[model samples]
Target: MPELIFRQPDGSTQLVSAENGSSVMQAAIRANVRGIEAECGGACACATCHVYIAPSDLLLIPAAKEEEEDMLDGVCAERREGSRLACQITVTDALGDMIIDIPDRQY
Candidate 1:
Protein backbone atom coordinates (compact mmCIF):
# COMPACT_ATOMS: atom_id res chain seq x y z
CA MET A 1 0.00 0.00 0.00
CA PRO A 2 1.05 3.56 -0.70
CA GLU A 3 0.50 6.40 1.75
CA LEU A 4 -1.34 9.60 0.90
CA ILE A 5 -0.95 12.80 2.90
CA PHE A 6 -3.80 15.23 2.52
CA ARG A 7 -3.12 18.82 3.56
CA GLN A 8 -6.38 20.49 4.34
CA PRO A 9 -7.36 24.14 4.04
CA ASP A 10 -7.06 24.66 7.78
CA GLY A 11 -3.51 23.35 7.68
CA SER A 12 -4.34 20.02 9.26
CA THR A 13 -3.04 16.89 7.59
CA GLN A 14 -4.38 13.37 7.42
CA LEU A 15 -2.25 10.45 6.37
CA VAL A 16 -3.99 7.42 4.96
CA SER A 17 -2.84 4.19 3.37
CA ALA A 18 -4.04 3.62 -0.13
CA GLU A 19 -4.57 0.30 -1.82
CA ASN A 20 -2.99 -0.27 -5.15
CA GLY A 21 -5.30 0.39 -8.12
CA SER A 22 -7.68 2.50 -6.05
CA SER A 23 -8.12 6.18 -6.82
CA VAL A 24 -6.75 8.76 -4.38
CA MET A 25 -10.30 10.05 -4.02
CA GLN A 26 -11.36 6.59 -2.89
CA ALA A 27 -8.73 6.57 -0.20
CA ALA A 28 -9.76 10.02 0.98
CA ILE A 29 -13.42 9.02 1.04
CA ARG A 30 -12.67 5.91 3.05
CA ALA A 31 -10.68 7.94 5.55
CA ASN A 32 -13.36 10.60 5.89
CA VAL A 33 -11.05 13.29 4.60
CA ARG A 34 -12.79 16.64 4.94
CA GLY A 35 -12.13 18.42 1.68
CA ILE A 36 -12.71 15.84 -1.02
CA GLU A 37 -16.43 15.81 -1.73
CA ALA A 38 -16.22 13.36 -4.67
CA GLU A 39 -19.71 14.27 -5.77
CA CYS A 40 -19.66 12.08 -8.83
CA GLY A 41 -18.18 9.14 -6.98
CA GLY A 42 -14.91 8.78 -8.87
CA ALA A 43 -16.66 8.83 -12.22
CA CYS A 44 -14.51 11.67 -13.61
CA ALA A 45 -17.65 13.65 -14.36
CA CYS A 46 -17.19 16.07 -11.47
CA ALA A 47 -14.42 18.32 -10.22
CA THR A 48 -15.27 18.00 -6.54
CA CYS A 49 -12.31 15.75 -5.87
CA HIS A 50 -9.86 18.46 -6.96
CA VAL A 51 -6.41 18.56 -5.38
CA TYR A 52 -2.93 19.83 -6.03
CA ILE A 53 -0.23 17.20 -6.20
CA ALA A 54 3.13 17.98 -4.72
CA PRO A 55 5.41 19.23 -7.49
CA SER A 56 8.11 16.70 -6.70
CA ASP A 57 5.66 13.86 -7.23
CA LEU A 58 4.21 15.21 -10.47
CA LEU A 59 6.18 13.02 -12.80
CA LEU A 60 4.99 9.89 -11.05
CA ILE A 61 1.48 10.53 -12.30
CA PRO A 62 0.30 9.95 -15.84
CA ALA A 63 -0.93 12.85 -17.93
CA ALA A 64 -4.57 13.57 -17.36
CA LYS A 65 -6.88 12.23 -20.04
CA GLU A 66 -8.84 14.66 -22.18
CA GLU A 67 -12.07 14.01 -20.33
CA GLU A 68 -10.45 14.82 -17.00
CA GLU A 69 -8.98 18.00 -18.43
CA ASP A 70 -12.42 19.05 -19.58
CA MET A 71 -13.90 18.58 -16.15
CA LEU A 72 -10.99 20.35 -14.55
CA ASP A 73 -12.00 23.51 -16.32
CA GLY A 74 -15.02 23.59 -14.04
CA VAL A 75 -13.19 23.12 -10.75
CA CYS A 76 -14.12 25.59 -8.02
CA ALA A 77 -10.58 26.55 -7.22
CA GLU A 78 -8.03 28.09 -9.53
CA ARG A 79 -6.47 25.38 -11.65
CA ARG A 80 -2.70 25.33 -11.58
CA GLU A 81 0.10 23.29 -13.12
CA GLY A 82 -0.25 20.60 -10.44
CA SER A 83 -4.00 20.58 -10.07
CA ARG A 84 -5.71 17.25 -10.60
CA LEU A 85 -8.99 15.55 -9.87
CA ALA A 86 -8.13 12.95 -7.25
CA CYS A 87 -10.45 10.41 -8.84
CA GLN A 88 -8.30 10.44 -11.95
CA ILE A 89 -5.19 9.56 -9.97
CA THR A 90 -4.78 5.84 -9.43
CA VAL A 91 -2.58 4.59 -6.65
CA THR A 92 0.36 2.40 -7.61
CA ASP A 93 3.53 1.13 -6.01
CA ALA A 94 5.49 3.55 -8.12
CA LEU A 95 3.69 6.48 -6.57
CA GLY A 96 5.13 5.66 -3.16
CA ASP A 97 4.16 8.48 -0.80
CA MET A 98 1.95 11.20 -2.27
CA ILE A 99 1.11 14.58 -0.78
CA ILE A 100 -2.09 16.17 -2.02
CA ASP A 101 -3.40 19.58 -1.01
CA ILE A 102 -7.11 20.10 -0.82
CA PRO A 103 -8.50 23.38 -1.96
CA ASP A 104 -10.53 25.68 0.28
CA ARG A 105 -13.70 24.66 -1.41
CA GLN A 106 -15.03 22.02 -3.81
CA TYR A 107 -18.03 23.80 -5.24
Candidate 2:
Protein backbone atom coordinates (compact mmCIF):
# COMPACT_ATOMS: atom_id res chain seq x y z
CA MET A 1 0.00 0.00 0.00
CA PRO A 2 1.03 3.58 -0.59
CA GLU A 3 0.08 6.63 1.41
CA LEU A 4 -1.46 9.75 -0.07
CA ILE A 5 -1.34 13.04 1.77
CA PHE A 6 -4.18 15.33 0.76
CA ARG A 7 -3.88 19.00 1.64
CA GLN A 8 -7.32 20.52 1.90
CA PRO A 9 -8.27 24.06 0.90
CA ASP A 10 -8.29 25.07 4.56
CA GLY A 11 -4.63 23.99 4.89
CA SER A 12 -5.63 20.84 6.72
CA THR A 13 -4.48 17.40 5.63
CA GLN A 14 -5.97 13.92 5.38
CA LEU A 15 -3.93 10.78 4.90
CA VAL A 16 -5.37 8.04 2.74
CA SER A 17 -3.85 4.70 1.91
CA ALA A 18 -3.98 3.26 -1.57
CA GLU A 19 -3.73 -0.19 -3.01
CA ASN A 20 -1.34 -0.78 -5.84
CA GLY A 21 -2.99 -0.43 -9.26
CA SER A 22 -5.99 1.35 -7.76
CA SER A 23 -6.75 4.93 -8.69
CA VAL A 24 -6.13 7.80 -6.29
CA MET A 25 -9.80 8.69 -6.49
CA GLN A 26 -10.68 5.22 -5.22
CA ALA A 27 -8.43 5.60 -2.21
CA ALA A 28 -9.89 8.97 -1.32
CA ILE A 29 -13.40 7.70 -1.75
CA ARG A 30 -12.76 4.63 0.36
CA ALA A 31 -11.13 6.67 3.08
CA ASN A 32 -13.82 9.32 2.91
CA VAL A 33 -11.39 12.11 2.22
CA ARG A 34 -13.52 15.27 2.09
CA GLY A 35 -12.05 16.93 -1.00
CA ILE A 36 -12.24 14.22 -3.65
CA GLU A 37 -15.88 14.19 -4.71
CA ALA A 38 -15.29 11.98 -7.80
CA GLU A 39 -18.76 12.65 -9.15
CA CYS A 40 -18.09 10.73 -12.31
CA GLY A 41 -16.50 7.84 -10.52
CA GLY A 42 -13.27 6.89 -12.31
CA ALA A 43 -14.56 7.38 -15.79
CA CYS A 44 -12.47 10.50 -16.48
CA ALA A 45 -15.59 12.40 -17.51
CA CYS A 46 -15.92 14.85 -14.64
CA ALA A 47 -13.31 17.09 -13.14
CA THR A 48 -14.86 16.84 -9.70
CA CYS A 49 -11.96 14.66 -8.63
CA HIS A 50 -9.38 17.25 -9.47
CA VAL A 51 -6.29 17.37 -7.31
CA TYR A 52 -3.05 19.26 -7.55
CA ILE A 53 0.10 17.19 -7.47
CA ALA A 54 2.97 18.48 -5.40
CA PRO A 55 5.64 19.61 -7.84
CA SER A 56 8.16 17.40 -6.12
CA ASP A 57 6.11 14.31 -6.87
CA LEU A 58 4.98 15.31 -10.32
CA LEU A 59 7.48 13.05 -12.05
CA LEU A 60 6.09 9.94 -10.49
CA ILE A 61 3.24 9.77 -12.99
CA PRO A 62 2.69 10.50 -16.63
CA ALA A 63 1.12 13.73 -17.82
CA ALA A 64 -2.60 13.94 -18.43
CA LYS A 65 -4.01 12.47 -21.63
CA GLU A 66 -6.24 14.46 -23.98
CA GLU A 67 -9.51 13.28 -22.46
CA GLU A 68 -8.48 14.19 -18.92
CA GLU A 69 -7.17 17.55 -20.08
CA ASP A 70 -10.50 18.30 -21.67
CA MET A 71 -12.38 17.66 -18.48
CA LEU A 72 -9.96 19.68 -16.36
CA ASP A 73 -10.73 22.81 -18.33
CA GLY A 74 -14.15 22.91 -16.69
CA VAL A 75 -13.04 22.61 -13.09
CA CYS A 76 -14.62 25.24 -10.87
CA ALA A 77 -11.25 26.08 -9.31
CA GLU A 78 -8.39 27.80 -11.04
CA ARG A 79 -6.22 25.36 -12.96
CA ARG A 80 -2.54 25.46 -12.25
CA GLU A 81 0.67 23.75 -13.37
CA GLY A 82 0.15 20.52 -11.44
CA SER A 83 -3.56 20.00 -11.87
CA ARG A 84 -4.74 16.42 -12.43
CA LEU A 85 -7.86 14.34 -12.03
CA ALA A 86 -7.41 11.89 -9.17
CA CYS A 87 -9.22 9.16 -11.09
CA GLN A 88 -6.42 9.08 -13.60
CA ILE A 89 -3.62 8.40 -11.15
CA THR A 90 -2.92 4.78 -10.36
CA VAL A 91 -1.12 3.98 -7.12
CA THR A 92 2.26 2.37 -7.56
CA ASP A 93 5.36 1.78 -5.54
CA ALA A 94 7.25 4.38 -7.49
CA LEU A 95 4.78 6.94 -6.20
CA GLY A 96 5.68 5.95 -2.62
CA ASP A 97 3.97 8.85 -0.90
CA MET A 98 1.95 11.39 -2.84
CA ILE A 99 1.09 14.83 -1.58
CA ILE A 100 -2.02 16.19 -3.26
CA ASP A 101 -3.59 19.63 -2.92
CA ILE A 102 -7.36 19.88 -3.05
CA PRO A 103 -8.86 22.97 -4.61
CA ASP A 104 -11.43 25.08 -2.71
CA ARG A 105 -14.44 23.78 -4.62
CA GLN A 106 -15.48 21.08 -7.05
CA TYR A 107 -18.89 22.37 -8.01
Top candidate when judged by lDDT against the true structure: 1
Candidate 2's residue-wise lDDT over 1-107, tens digit each? Answer: 78888889888988787899999899899999997899888999989999999777888998899999999999999999899999999999887667889999999
**Model 1 / residue 19 / CA error / Å:** 0.3
Residue 93's lDDT within candidate 1 is 85
Candidate 1 overall Cα lDDT vs. reference? Answer: 0.91
* Clashing pairs for predicted structure model 1, backbone only: none
RMSD of each: 0.9, 0.9
Q: How many clashes show up in model 1? A: 0
lDDT score at residue 7, model 2, on the 0-100 scale: 87
| Number of colliding residue pairs in each model | 0, 0
Among all windows of 10 consecutive residues in model 2, the one with the lowest summed lDDT is 93-102
Off by over 4 Å in 1: none
